[model samples]
Every structure is written in structure tokens, then in C-alpha cells.
Target: MLSLSDLRQRPLNVLCAGDVERHETTEWANSDDIDVRNRFADLLQRAFHA
Candidate 1:
């Protein structure tokens, strides 16, 4: 986990598992895609500053 102070101290870059075109769907939540799942996790991590 990363603290807010730590996040402010450095740049935070979130990378997708593949091409951007591959993840251009609005479906997330219960999607069965690994890339979508990983992207969702990334979103949560940033939102909670974890």
C-alpha cells in the first residue's frame, strides 16, 4: 500500500495489461475479462490511495 504523502512525492503511472483499444469498453463490474478486472483494481487502488 502507498500513503498519500508517498503518492505526492512521486509520479504514479498506471499501465494496462494490453493495448488501449482492447479495454475501451464500458463494461467492468462483473466482466469476465482479466484486463478489465486488473483495470478495475487499479482504479480502486488509486481511489483509496492504497
Candidate 2:
């Protein structure tokens, strides 16, 4: 797990909470649930807007 301080030290555009795996492409690698995806989208929006 990454601490707040650790995250603050890096440049992060989006943060998703789930079991993620490395993928060959740039596609999503976490949960496929609609709710999860929606939340992730919201987070991504906030990240960029902030």
C-alpha cells in the first residue's frame, strides 16, 4: 500500500483502489464493475481539474 506521503512525492493523475495487474496495453487493469469505473472516472476528472 502507498502512504499519503509517498503519493505526495510523486506525480499521480489518477488513483484506483482495487487488485490491479500489469498489462501490455494502456487499458484499465482493475475492476470492471460499473460503479467502480464510474468512481474512477470521477476521480480522474477531479485529478485533471484540480
Candidate 3:
């Protein structure tokens, strides 16, 4: 996610609830509901002016 954001040169807003080495996780990668994607989308949505 951060990689794609860096590629696009955008503001990265990350809301983390725990300490971690890296953000990458199998939880999102192997699930029907993507929590990481949803969180990233939340950041994107708030960044956009309505």
C-alpha cells in the first residue's frame, strides 16, 4: 500500500493500533474483507475535498 502511495506521490495516512515490523500481513491478503484496504481507503476518502 505504501509502495503504491509512494509511486503516486501522495500523502500516506496510516492508523496503526499496534507495534509492528512491517505493514504487510496475510490477514488482508487471504481474506474476503480487506481491513488494510478499507483503512487506506478511509485515508484517501478524507483527503479528497467534497
lDDT of each prediction vs. the true structure?
0.50, 0.45, 0.47
Q: Model 2, range 1-50, lDDT digits (tens) per residue?
A: 32222332335424635443433212432666766556556656676786
Task: Highest lDDT: give the candidate number.
Answer: 1
* Regions of model 1 farther than 4 Å from truth: 1-26
Per-residue lDDT over 1-50 for candidate 3, one digit per residue giving the tens place of the 0 to 100 score: 33323332223334333432344445445556677768656655666744
Clashing pairs in 1: none
- Model 3: per-residue Cα lDDT at residue 35: 74
TM-score for all models, in order of appearance: 0.42, 0.40, 0.33
What is the Cα root-mean-square deviation between model 1 and the actual structure? 8.3
> Worst 10-residue stretch by lDDT in candidate 3?
1-10
Give me the runs in candidate 3 sitting further than 4 Å from their true place: 1-33
RMSD (Cα, Å) of model 2: 7.7
lDDT of 1 by residue, 1-50 (tens): 32223332325323333323323235664688888667776776897874
Model 2: per-residue Cα lDDT at residue 36: 54
Q: Give the root-mean-square deviation of each candidate in angstroms.
A: 8.3, 7.7, 7.4
